[model samples]
Target chain A: MKKINRRQLLQGMVTGAGCVAAASMFGSAAFAADTRIRHFWWGNPSRDERTYKVIDLFKNANPGFDVAGETIGWGDYWTKMATQTAGKNMADLVQMDYRFLFEYVHRGALLPLDEYFGKTLHLEDFDKSAIAGGMVDGKLYALNIGSNSQVMIYNKRLFAEAGIEFDPIKWNQAEQMDIAKKLSASTPKGVHGIDDATMNPIVWEAWTQQRGKTFYADGKVQAVAADLESFWEYWKEMRESGAAPSADVSVANLGFKMTESGIVTGATAMSQFWSNQIVGVQSLMKDEIGAAMLAHKKGGMPGQFIKPSMFMALTRDTKNPELATKYMNAWVNDPAQTAILGLERGVPASSKVRAALEPNLTVSEKVSVDYFNAIQSSVGPLPPPPPKGAGEVNAAFIRMGTNVILGRISIKDGAAEFIDEASSIVERAS
Target chain B: MRKFFVRNLPGYAFLTPWLLGFFLLALGPMLISLYLSFTKWDMVGDPQWVGLAQYEYMFLKDKRFWQSLDVTFTYVILAVPARLAFALMIAIVLDKGIRKIGIYRALYYLPSILGASIAIAILWREIFNIDGVVNAVLINFGIQGPNWIGNPDTSLYTLVVLAMWQFGSPMLIFLAGLRNIPTELYEAAEIDAASKAKQFFSITLPLLAPVLFFNIILQTIEAFKTFSSAFIISNGDGSPADSLLFFTIYLFNEAFTYFRMGYASALAWTLLIIIGLFTAVSFYTSKYWVYYENERD
Candidate 1:
């Protein structure tokens, strides 16, 4: 080999250094590009618009990261999520429902977030209870995005016309029945008094809780048979007295939103709904709509609680777990995002965010906040995740209730049949 | 050997795509499902071996299974025969001298093309709703009708009527069978002083037996798998006391809604066996009834 000159050596060193610098630049660029995170949520166009705006803000704040947002309707949400997770192709961040959080967590489909929150996320400023709702087996697998409590909504015009003083906070079953009857009696033809949904699990849970009983204990239904019997009996009497819609009408109304419900559509006076659904109900009503407490049983515990309405979770299959956590934290903590989201996902769980949004809140948002706050003290703990096969159980309740109303089965027989069927579903799932 | 392979490469190439599709798409999933039927799975956790338990639950314990079977059989019995008979009758009418034959044929075939679709099923619900056009027409005729879609007593019959109305495919098949019958034979029968009804029973019925059997088998299988109309109209609950609880609907609820994949797989196998048995019975009985002109005997 020939001897190398000092100039050639210096030149070689400079070229090597330049190449290393360029390679590092390209590597960092690829790392930034590969850091793209996807978040999946279930909502309508309004929610999608709000969520996309939030994602854009998140992207702006975290300049080195890319974010993608996906949304599906509520009905198809779980099916798509479950299919994707089972295939190990889940999105980085997901909007989860409490109803399915336990199932998903138990199946190891969710990544535990305790490490992420305490170490990586550093979300000490966030409300602890909002973070606690995601805990399972001493590990947090989700973070609460918002909260909600159920309420009874009534048509103010119809109530005033019927000369019924609707005070759900203090109303017992008898009082509710009386009001229902009076409203039905005084209302003009073609309008019903109440549009009750027997299939709503929230109603069933509330009924069970008012009796100081649990829907499930030791993985079995523990409520007294008479409690359920009485619930069916109350509705039966309502139907027979024409205080509620007929069986045919009730069946026809199944699966419809509150907006399409007879109560909001000027066909009935009252109905039970979530506080967040007030807008949907208000949109369909020609008159003012007001919220009231969930009607309680006489001398029974007010069985209601502000449950973590919805959660943002990281799927176990996520390729970028830390990035997903960062995105979720940003989405929940960001003030502007919370403002746009408002109380649609329910009231904001982050105290800071709620305080930030409260001053500029709309009338509807105020109504939701006031409704939830007013009932906050009276609300009971969230009932345990509904039993497996809960959908079938709910359907069975509707069918059995319809049978009773249609005189195909007696109320007593229908009650027994419904319990037996639902209990069997629980037992089979176990 | 290389020369031989290369010489037949085009033939093998032609078969390769179908073979690949079968192995990858159809056969692979089918085999997996077969294995899954013998295991307990929730589509989330790993499947556990529980051989025959799913089948045992389905055959021995599930009341819903029997209810679904009854509903499916009722639908098959009502829909398949009615559809075939109506199709044959229309085919006979169209075979006769008629004006605008093509228009009538197209008009009658429209429903069959749209029969198994979601939109048409939704339309069916609207047309049969409490205040739907059917009741409106009934009111015009000075008659009051009960809520057809809401009443359990009549909901299944409404579906039966809907199925009967979609006789287009079978009608076209019957029409083809009718046209295949030499016109000279009908003319000779007419010359022999045979009445139209007698000629139909003696000539058209015998000749159309093979096509009728084919239509019955196909329609019966379709009826057993009916889901969309029942699901949409019943709001996915098989409402009104499970009057419209078709087999596939129940199977789907079990698998997805309830997360009982093993049980659903077993139900699928049971349905397969039922269809197989029904088809076998039809083939066995066909010897006594169906006549093929090309039969050696």
Candidate 2:
């Protein structure tokens, strides 16, 4: 090696780094003319593939229009979104969740879509209630792509093997519990009849709805100690009766991948799924998956309600606002686009699109649509979007719920702690 | 001053990149985080000054903070010593005359080379999964294995076992240290008819004290910073009643997951102090045990 001075080495290093950085900058600049608008959404592989296909369709129609699609598992989406928001690099189009919409809107992270409705977007065929769900302070900030409700999907093969009578409608929680106890007895060793719902907030929220109580109202916790105590007691019973799998089995099955879910892995016969996820859930397993309305109190109010499966929002940081709005319209209301997207997002929010696409839905897609429609009359109005600090409340719920399920804490104490923590978390954020 | 500058020009020039990097990246961010520890802010908005309230809450109220500390300490206490002992044992065995010693050393060091990778973390998760290899082996012995990764009682221990399995770097250090101990001493012990155990205690251990202490500090610090494997195995949020809630994982969650940047800053400072205290105490106590070959005094 030639003798090298320290100054010479430093100069070489600086030149090398400068060249690499300049190369990368030019590398992206080469494609800057493509008129790209990035879209970000969280979904399973099935929904993601359809989204990619739809993007391709749009690109083919509008020459030079480019979309870079980004997808993540549901758990990591908001973390990524929050980081992006802080950096002011949010994608042009965002698939938003109902719970986080209020926070994003309050922070002025999303654009109000009221201006885009008449020109770049036409949403006349969309449901009023679905649109209203995305409204905050009378300004439409997001457009619901589809409407979904909570549903219980069961393994029909497992039910058949156990010789249980299938009752898709008019069933009560008591009957479900009895079926849970009876079905587990007939299933194979270590396989439970019901998935563990102790840590799932949706199941608890549905129970609160069933009993004519709201879990959250006007950015304050409306759930009382009794609401949690009773809900936890039910799951505690579910676990003790061998109806639900043990915590270990449940945690293992709760892997980030959809394929590892309890129902898909044959760890449980019945599991909770959103009506929109029926097809995605079905795609993971070989068995025929069936879904029904969630069981409620025998004479209680309707527990399930139609809520936006997800919404497409235009980010405040978007460079191409008009193009983003046009894409949003295509995603939400365009019949041709819906033909490609189908019920993967949820049952279509637009009636015109739904009717046009119904005749062509796959077997699982039809099942989801039928289940969504069957509960139409009994379902409640769209729930108020979760208050700010809903994320903290949810994390606490899972942690405290895990404590109770694993016998680490008493039911009464766990419920009390959860309500207190959730209330405080909501209050603090406000 | 001109003469001084000219004489040191090359050295200063060589240091410019690292100096710039330190100021721009490491030291600058560290100072900002220290300031941020006194404020309450999500990353999206302007930071509001809370003035020690973040630290106050962490010290006085945060249950998860205590849980994370407890979990991390338990890991350090259990894993560091066990790892050191295993590495020392393996080093001693490998020090004996053996064919193809270089290959054996490389083979033994493979796990540590891959230890910090996400792939290994995922593989660890898979091996402890319900239908994974560990349970399969346990089944043959008519022993039903509890979910190692899921059960709170065993999850941290499984991570400790993983820590022990990757003792390659320390083992290599121990091998080098063992070589430095002259074979003449062992031969003298043999002439005295000292038992193998007696010779080890008298000759091997005391001679290896400095290296042992060095490995202890290295391994303990490494254990404190354990994040990736714990984060992966716990499925990110420290599930099954927060049993796998390592301190670093909790700090990450507070920062990113909950958007509690201010509290997270306080947590980062607290961890720094804790690791600093541990290192200081280790050095303080090392005087009693560590035997240096050269005595300055």
Candidate 3:
């Protein structure tokens, strides 16, 4: 055997190392190609299982792309996303909320979808209002996943027991109170007529909107005092009449999730929630829970609106912007995918998707869809974007409610404080 | 000098790791924070220079800042003395020959190690909840209990009690200080017909003054910076009308929840200055009370 020259030996070693590196890189790429796109949505196990089945169907239909599903609890979703975004590591696709979309978009952490769905994502086929909800400053930040409306859920058994023949659609404060009083009188031990929500800002906003007032005007709070005072008076009456739970019970109930909600758990006969949450509440109850238009005063403008429940946006930080847009488009537009998702995120915004899912829907899903449809013509205009420090404002609302419920403050005083605090928060944020 | 460097080169090399870490990790961040204190930042966009505007707003306009300061000072004033008294009493009790003294010592010391954690704070919330064990115990005695964690009037007091409960660390230090006092002094006092109380005031207290001083300073600082228990118990909202809103918790809210990083940084500097003033006052006052065993006057 003859010895090779030094140059030839060095060249041979280099070539061999390069070939090995290339082979490993090729192997990884091939492995990645075979793996499914990991999609995450915040939900409970039931929703997770359903989503997994949907992903399986997607993989089957689209052979080249496999999709993995992940679900987190709603509370942990934003926190996890914020941390992931800060670390410059995020899932391929995520369920996004309207509140957080601005945070992501402004931070350049989400991909805009102007080119993905036509030259600009066309609004002609979509409900213009719903499509507009997902746009920020004329740029499409997220694809509208679904639309939801607020509805009142009541126990039919409770209503029958109270002998209350109330039409929530046309009920005034006096009529609703009459029904509430009857229900309170007839409600058995360990149950109440209503699960009072003193902390719900949206409820106050809706009431005010019905009165032709808005929460904001000229970038300042416009309807805080009147809206808050009305809400406080309403809740105070309910509390005084034994229609709502005591302060302690109410606080504990506030901490409970949808499954453990007082209404669903039979502690109360009626509650207000987003239409999409109907199924989760119904699943926890033995009694049949039914939906109605949120109770309003007679001749009042219906303040209910079909707002985008949430959106799915591609992060700007994503290395594969085109891929992210394609994934979001698929999630939003694909009828097969929406059919499996159903009214889990309210009604799918895409008409085609909604139609596809409508035929095979469960009773609960149909109820939600019907609820939204009934109020479609009655809804007021979409609300403006909530100001920053909105969270602090909400907390302040809860605190004021606690004070009122505890009898530490009068309803009028609590209302005044809430308005003052909320306005201050808006001012600070501005 | 050249010979010394050659001989001590390995020793210097060994110290380099710690020296590098101190400058890079601790000192670097401290300087950065100082600079950040003067700027208005929200963690998203670039920081804006605001000079002393944040400080001015905090000192002049922010009612929450003053409220938090009052709460924190009240906590420090009550909690530090109460904690010291409890620790000193326990230390003296344990110093007496008792059965299973070591076991009692270890058992009492356990909470100090675990008390400051997030888990314990959550557990504290549960223990103080309306339907929790404390209420159950009260109810068993035919007594209805107030909502301890949910009541604004009693919420801060509950935290004060929690701080006082973790007296084991201070007690341990006091015990060591108690033991270090020369037995001869006590013995001489005993021969002189000195009462136990008298001996305590004359010998034990004087000798332990240094330790007591140290404990007061440390505990006051700890009480001032209390955040975890207040934050977790309040679910990070300073609930029931900001009753449990400690200074650091308020600072955290401004920094993270409200995204007022510049304001929070100014708050940080204010806290440092306050603590420095407190430490300075303690030192100045120590001359009148604290005794030094090693001093030659």
Candidate 4:
């Protein structure tokens, strides 16, 4: 048997502890070299697949770069992003939205990409307006992935069945409602004419813009109560006239996918969606679909504007921003990568990439391009980026609108409550 | 002190992991949250001291706060009693005289295991949708069913029914409690020519009171804290005019969705107080009904 004294035992324990401390320190340092930066974005499966392919191409292009990707559905994206933000573990490369980009930038979560525009990222080929949309307070914090405008997507078969042939750009709200009633009268028993868009903030934004005011300006709710009341009153009348689906149906399909929407499910003949959503809606249906501009306000201010489809940004705390920026460059600037992504993200922000991909574009994608070109000049100026706490305002709009359309509250009352609620929500953020 | 330390050394060593977790993960965050409840924290910036401002806003300025409280209280009040009563009824049925009761027990308990999941909530949404199974079934009987999860008036009841459907675990506990009741007492009642109803009123009610009390408290707290089903069903914004906004979902939205960490912390403490008050009330009232075998009520 071996005998051990206190000196020997103490010395052995100290050496072991020292060894563990050194191993842990060095182990983490080594782990950093092999760390695969995580990239997170929200998209449907098609976008997810294409993004993975682009990441693969990026890896091939830069052998030293390694990336792990996470894609969330649009509905769950913000929840995941916010939780990760709170935990200080946000993805290295984040796909941002115009509404959220300002909030993130204001929170110091996003790194300004302006300094790297020429050094690491190639912005020479990107559109001036596209680049402008990604700017916050004159500093570029994100890169526009694509450009998009809202479009009214109607089922062609439903339109033909209803004997309705209307030009999207020329149609006014009254004419649109008349067409909706015609379609509803001719459609199946359970079907309505138009999916309700009153709860959608985009519609309200357009409505507010038509009256020469924006929904939000200078971090405040800018629309007057009268404008809001008129917007709600019109929708309430539409619901009562059966030109749009009932409040119950709209509520049930709330936050649903294009595949599960009233238009695709044949419960409504027409629905309005972002231009990029056209392809996703097309994939789910055998029925032919047609695209048109949203009905303009009759003799009112311009109601349409081109906006960034989404933005690609770098998180401030990323370990490898250079590697991430290189990948972002490939995602938007590389012709080969851009072609694979196609119109899934909308028209490419890079004019060169757009021209290159236009010839090989699918028929549906061609429609989006033609629509974008047709409305490019007539559309209004882009509204200011949505303010912080804009999300709460959007929620309040949906809730109060539901109340009005469901006859639970008068339009005037709902409008008053909404202004009170929305203004406070915006003010609280500032 | 030395002798105590020596005697408890092995136990302390074994408890180290849990103790560390409790202090670092739970208690540490809890203390920070308590401090945060008195400040304004946006999660990305330094916290600002704004004593009682969050509470004042929640009570005086925020309509959704009061709305969520009403919704949660209504849910707990309705769901707990309905769930417990349903559980007790089934437990009595199973305990009285069933062969191969294990299969029946497992079948009944399945929903409890799966009920609170997001998948089940999605399934619930599908079943209650405008063109879903319930409405499809109703059509066959020449009756039009209102959209169950869409109409605000009816949406809450659907969630309540969901709560009642997961009564399996409470039922199992009641089963165990029923088994513990002595057969001799029933025999004695029978020998005295007591009626079945009379025996149940005299023996079963008093004996099973403790289990019922436990189930009531547990289920009430569970109902108050429900998030996934309400979240999934309402698509996380508690749409249809915020009818499905449970307290926890509202708190989550305030914290993660709105990034109002201090406000969320305040909401958390309010919920803690609400649950504590409810549990205390239940315990205080228990002496009126609950009876133990060895101790007097």
Which one wins on DockQ? 2
Two-way DockQ contest, 1 vs 3, winner = 1
What tens-digit string does per-residue lDDT give for candidate 4 at A1-430? 1222324433543332221101000001112443467788998778999999988887887777688888988767887787677667788889899888988898899998877778889999878888899888889998889889988888899899889989877688888889989988888887888888778777888888989998888777888889888887787767778878877778777675676788888889888899988887887788888888888888988888999988888997688787778788888888789888998988888878888987887778877888888888678999988888887888888888777767788878888889988888888987
Docking class of 3: incorrect
lDDT of 4 at A241: 81
The Cα error of candidate 4 at residue A125, in Å, is: 2.1
Alpha-carbon RMSD to native, per candidate: 13.7, 5.2, 11.3, 8.1
| Model with the higher lDDT, candidate 1 or 4 | 4
Q: Model 1 TM-score?
A: 0.92
Q: Write one digit per residue (lDDT tens) for candidate 3, span B1-297.
A: 999999999998999998796566556655666777789776556678989998888888787789889889888988889889999999999998789989999999999899988989988887887777899999989998887887877788888889889999999889888888879998899999999999999999988887787778778777877878888887676777777778888887776666676787788778877876776677778779977765556
lDDT for each residue of candidate 2 in B1-297, tens digit (9 for 90 to 100): 999999999999999999997676666777778888899978777889999899888889888899999999999999999999999999999999689999999999999989889999999988998778999999999988888887777889989999999999999989998988989999999999999999999999998887777678668777888889888888887766789899888988888787888888888888877776776677778778877765456
Task: Kindly report the fnat of each predicted structure, to 2 decimals.
Answer: 0.25, 0.39, 0.12, 0.41
- Evaluated at residue A10, the lDDT of candidate 2 is 35
TM-score of each model, in listed order: 0.92, 0.92, 0.85, 0.93
Question: Candidate 2 or 3, higher TM-score?
Answer: 2
lDDT of 4 by residue, B1-297 (tens): 999999999999999999897676566777788788899987777799999999999999888999999999889989999999999899999997899999999999999999978889999999998888999999999988888998888899999999999999999989998998889999999999999899888999888876776667667767877888999998887777899888888888887678788898889888877776776676677678866555532
lDDT per residue, candidate 1, A311-420, as tens digits?
Answer: 98887767788777777776777666667777778777777787788788666667777787677667777666666666667777777766766788776777777778
Report chain A TM-scores, every model. Answer: 0.87, 0.88, 0.85, 0.89
Error of 3 at B168 (Å): 2.1
User: Measured against the native two-chain assembly using Cα atoms, what DockQ does each of the candidate structures obtain, in the order listed?
Assistant: 0.12, 0.29, 0.09, 0.25
Off by over 4 Å in 3: A1-95, A103-109, A119-126, A168-170, A252-261, A264-266, A334-336, A339-342, A359-367, B1-13, B16-20
Output the chain A TM-score of model 3. Answer: 0.85
